[model samples]
Target chain A: MTDRPENDHWLVRPTTIRLLWWVFCIVLALTVIAQFGFSVKGYFGVDGWIGFGAVFGFFACLVMVLVAKGLGLILKRGERYYDDGDSDV
Target chain B: MSEILSPALILFAAALLIGPARGHWRTAILLIAPLVTLWAVWQVPDGVIGTLSFLEYQIEPLEGSPLRRLFATIFALMAFGGGFYAFRHARWYELATAYAYAAGAIGVSFAGDFITLFVYWELMALFSTVVVWCGGTPAARSAGIRYAIMHLLGGVILMVGIVGVALQTGSVDIQPMLATDFSTWMVLIGILFNAAAPPISSWLADAYPESSPTGSVFISAFTTKAAVFALILIFPGEPVLIGVGLYMVMYGIIYALLENDVRRILAYSIVNQVGFMVCAVGIGTELALNGAAAHAFAHIIYKALLIMSAGVVIIRTGENKCTNLGGLFRTMPLTAVCGIVGALAISGFPLTSGFTTKTMISQAAATEGLVAVYFLLAAASAGVFLHAGIKFPWFVFFQRDSGLRPRDAPWNMAAAMVFFATLCILIGVFPEALYRFLPYPVTYQAYVAGKVIFYLQLLLFSGLAFFLLLPLMRRTRTISLDTDWLWRVVLLRIANAVSTVLLALGTKFATLASGLLGSLRSLSERYFGQLASEESGRRGVFARDWPIGVTALWIAVLLTAYVFIYYI
Candidate 1:
């Protein structure tokens, strides 16, 4: 590893990261809250529910990650899983 | 000469020349060949302009249409772009094979008959396997072999379907097909295999990342997208495709989330992105077809750009895994920027080409009152943002520094990337340029305020989720098994066991039979005379062991015949 000081880049500075996270949250909230500003419509009942895009997007990703982790338990193997002669079968 | 020349032949000629040409001559062919093909692509008039006799069938070598031209143009452009990126680094043979592969894609694009189409399809499968082998590793060789098997199997199924249809209908012409019959279903499954649909989807993620850095860039553009072109032409409105496409979209997302290799992550995303197009083809309306074609057009530019950026990293640092890559944005600013652009474009972020094109598919589904499909597609879109949009860039470029400061891309590669990156944004801002080339009338607008806001909310919150769950996505040096385990692991084990049992049985039988025959031969020799001695029989040349490749080939031939007979 390079012996560069830990927080050399401004983007990685702790304060800057923390401030950016706050700004990011505000932008996220505004996207959801801005829905009320517009007349939101949906072809389906569940989609038109308040904050549906936010809720759906969040939970959808969360579910995918969980599903992936669950599947990985069975499917994931060492990088050399198929390399050994015995395992090649 | 015929009034119309096949652009495929131009690329093929270049492929032939690439092997012999050296230095400036090689560079000139690489740059000039695809441009010539591109010009030839535009000059051909629309429809099946001409046909020639192939046995009893009149095979169309070239046909021109808005859609065909669109795919061909991009393929030629990719040949140009990929050539420009690779000429300085990749070996001559890799370039030659990649050009032939591109020819296969262009051939499929303009093929008006099943005969011509199958020829091109097999051409692609053959050449792309060589491209995969260009990785020059044992892993690449194995993966290439497996990839070849899967695609060739797909080709056989497609050919059977085509022959069945021809026998039934008395025509070789390519036309819209439904999966109502056994024949058409085979065709659908065949195309779906290449589209990286379930069960067989693993071949793509299996083979692509195994290829050399530049080879992967070329590998990404064709194959599946050409499958998309086939799906667009042949199986549009096949209802089963909607379910299959949705499954692929979700599968790509989930697997990509668990992936450590940056190129593998991108490979899965190809499935995810193509899923959108496949589903759009299934939707099978004017808007949906246009959406599929336009997205394909935009996708090649951006997707190639994305892999080119990854190739730059692989070329410079020789590390493709997320665990080994980080803080690359420090030195390789251009590559980082281009990668970010591709990631955002792929996620359908507002004002990107994906935004302009992908939304049309969702709009098509919603307009058709496919509420379940619409919602599912939207969720999958969010998932795309998580795994590909955020996960790939964050891990490879912006995570904790791995203390690797690789040099930026070479000028040729950088120029190629800048060229594509400009297109990604330009298409996003002005969808009309792409829309004008669609197969049908283009009336859809991609930039309405409400839709943009909905997508922004959708994609951004997914980003929020990505950061929140970043810990769970920690890269590990492992592989996630897909349905390919059925053959690579399960069936292989069964074959091994069966072969073991058979070998033992054969040995026992040989010993018993030889002993029994020896006694009978002693009796006969006592009575009259033995014709030949057992010692000489055992020492003969015919007693030599058969090669495993020969056994495998015989087995393949038997299985293929069995499938053909059964399907018939």
Candidate 2:
């Protein structure tokens, strides 16, 4: 019931957030280059499809991360959740 | 070409020697054992070594085929490297169990018959369980139990297949079996389970990371790679494995991407790496088979190196989660370097073992015009870098410093990692040393400008993708659910629920039946008015004393009838 931001400290780090944004832009730029660079060089002319594949693969990975995070909200146990006895400590 | 016992058997004997030795000497014994075994393996003749007869069947103990020798050589090397790593750090019991496990694997490698293979296969299961137990934690005990059950299940399936094959064909030789018969399917499934194929893949992640830090390094090397060896030997050229391997490859990347535990990520990636080998086995060309073999050898070294580095971090910081760890490169520079080398090798970066080994398999797929598989494998290659190659060392060693400084890994640990790191580069730079030992003759070259440039572009771009998606790929304190959840959670819950309901229903049925029986007894007593009882005044005509007379008369009559019938 607690607000997500209130509980998760990782979301609060401004530096991390900025770094993540920078990384995202860099990856996007590379994908664009990989997709189009071969085409400009006339390397078998599969540039359009290759670009699509790269874009699709990257997004698909993003979706998986999102889905996993959502599922983790429900299924994630306490760090010691499985330790029902005294042995874990 | 000399007469000698198989190196695998000698290794087993050496393991036996270590079992009874004092603790201090046991480490020495463990270290020496593998070197001796390696020497013995080198001495094996280039033909069938020995055969034993059982009933009407012949069981070959040692076969000197190039493929078998190749696998056995690596197994011996792993034992040597693993023994050295474990010798200084592991408990005596763990050392003994590890040797036994190594012996069982090597035994399978040289086994010329299915019977010998199955026997050693089960031994691997049993001893590896002991290694897991040596973690000396309750979590390890439970995980070890589950690990044993999964492997024993695989072993049982294998046993049944072997028996069925023997019954049907009247032979037990461990030769290529490409049939679609029930027995072959059974064998395939059995091997696939150990390969950590889908639906049962969760066992590796669940059990491996739970092992003792040193134990995980040894545990990582043997079972799955041995399965790869068997697959290459028996089910080569089966197309079904292509799909199976692809599934494992993607599963490893996705799950590893989601993983927080450093070792678990590596464990998942092990499945991914083995998947490549398995897929190559499906491709089953000479090139593909060699790729699988070479990859297995290289993978064992680098993967162990990775785990050893992680093991050092865990030992020093007492933390395994990426979220809790970072910036140890400042202190543990050697470990960082070793780990990065391992990551590079695993990611198949140019001039690394993975590049030299894994590319051959992909090249085989391409040559065969399996375009879809080739593409998916290529993407998965990228994903491997995204998840493991970059993610592993990045978060553990480099990312933002958590302001916690840990010392360098121990001399022994560093030595082990350095040795493996050296092997990774040595094999990459001078692949012919490994190529000469392969099952097939060497014609493939890994280093070319086109290939190197393409691979670097692919991997580095993937690295670019991973960092760009850092927000999405951020670590969380969560364990990803895997196919094992079907058995570990759902099936187990169903079984418990059914048992509970069955017990309740049985209690109710018992209570009702007992009550009905009581009522019937009373009803009989009341309705018959105790007439059947001798104490009752109203008895039947044949009851009481008259019954005795009638019985005597009937006995005589029956005797007369019997005599008449017999005579007639």
Candidate 3:
């Protein structure tokens, strides 16, 4: 990995990253609030609850990442695992 | 007997002429054939335009349905884009064969019967193998061979199924059928194999990333989507497909999340995106079918754009792994932006093509009152955002600067990407443009307050999860295992064992035969020819001590004959 210099692009600056986090939180909160402005119609009984999309989306991604990590424990191998003569068809 | 010429024949003509034509003439053929095919795709009305009597069965060679026209139109458009992207740098043979491959896709689009479909399907298998070989490396050669074998296997199964169906039904017309009997089930499995469904999907990841930069863009567009087109026509509402589609969806996401190679990640996502289409086909409602068809049309454009951008990155940086690339947007800004547009479109961001089409599948599940499928699909949407939408751009463009600044994509490549990117946005903004082409009438509204808010929250939260688990998602110099292990490793070991046993069994028989024929072999050798080592006095045919190389040469000749007969 390349080291970040003191004076780099503004987008990657420490202060900017912090500010971006705040903005992300605000926007996320607002999406949940935006649910009240419009009725988030749900075909299922529970999906209609306020902020359900946000909750489901978060946990869904979290589960997927964890599941992938678990799979990697068994399946991941060195990049050249298929490079040897025995592996070649 | 047809009023309009089949557009596929026009592409086939171009494929034939591309090799012999010189510079300007070649350019004209490349640019004009797709335009002519595009025109013919529309000109042929919604019916069988041509037919022929093959072995007493009347077969439709050129047919047009709304679904067929949509697939053919995108295929022609893809040919135009891929040809433009590749014409400047790709080899002449690559261009010729890719056009033939596109012709195969267009032919399948218009195929009205099982025989016509099988013929075009084999054409795709034939030329696409050549395209994969055009990757021009040892890895490419190996992968291409494996790719050829896998597709040949698929082709045989499909041929067997087609023959079985013809015998059973005494008709060969394309129509909807569930996998009830043996023949239809075989047909379903055959098409699913091409769709990159599991137990065999590793071929896409195995061979596609090994292709030449521009070669992959074309390769990525046609084969699987054509399979989806077949599914939409022949297997719509196959309830079995729902379970199969769900498995494909999760499998793509899990595997993509573990991938470190940039191209492999995108290739896995192709499987993911096609999962949505396959599932929608299973839903089999008009709205659901429309979603599947529209998603396929939009998918070809955006997926090609994504691959084109990845191709540019591979060429510019001379890198394929995410671990070796980052901050390329600093120099290759246009390529970066185009890549980001493709990522967003694929993630179904509002105002992108994916959103307009993909949402309908979820809506279909909800409308069907399938509670579990609906929620799983919604979660899969978020997972798609995690793996493809955020993960792709973050690693390739926004991670630590690799400090290797390369020039942006050339004018033609940029033009191709820009063209596809424009189509992505245009389709998203005015989905009615794509909706009119669906096999079923579409009454769905893509943009509304409720839908946008829901998708936004879902996507944004998924983005949050991605960053929080960023360490887990770190790029690694590794590959993850999949079902291909059965053939690549397990089956190879088995073959070696079987060969060893056979060799042991043959030794005794060989000794007896040599003793019997020793005198006659020596006499014939004297009359026919002299051995290279005549002074050694080892002169009998079976008794002679043959050089290892001569025996190897004979084996090679036998294998060559076997391969030739396989194709014939």
Against the true structure, whose DockQ is highest? Answer: 3
Better candidate number, 1 or 2, judged by TM-score? 1
User: Which regions of candidate 3 fall more than 4 Å away from where they truly are?
Assistant: A1-6, A85-89, B2-4, B507-568
Question: Which pairs of residues collide in model 3?
Answer: none
Model 1, position B255: C-alpha lDDT score: 88
**On a 0 to 1 DockQ scale, where is model 2?**
0.15
Q: Of 2 and 3, which scores higher on TM-score? A: 3
Computed on C-alpha atoms, the DockQ of candidate 1 is 0.57
Per-residue CA lDDT of model 1 for B1-568, tens digit only, reads 4754588999999999999999999999999999999999998889887888887988888889999999999999999999999999999999999999999999999999999999999999999999999999999999999999999999999988988888888889999989999888888888887898887899999999999999999999999999999999998888888988898899899889888898999999999999999999999998999999999998998889899999999999999999999989889999999999989999999989999999999999999999888988999999988988888889888999888989999999999999998989999999999999999998998987678778888999999999999888888998888898788888999999999999999999999999999998777665544356443334323335769998899999999999999999
Q: Count the backbone clashes (under 3 Å) in each candidate.
A: 0, 2, 0
Compared to the true structure, candidate 1 yields what TM-score? 0.92
TM-score of 3: 0.90
User: Between which residue pairs do clashes occur in model 1?
Assistant: none
Candidate 2 residue pairs that clash: A23-B468, A24-B468
Better of 2 and 3 by lDDT: 3
> How would the candidate models be sorted by lDDT, starting from the highest?
1, 3, 2
Predicted candidate 2 versus true structure: per-residue lDDT over A14-61, tens digit per residue: 666788768766765564555444532212234234444455445545
Taking chain A of candidate 1, what TM-score results?
0.84
Model 3's interface RMSD: 2.7
Error of 3 at B460 (Å): 0.6
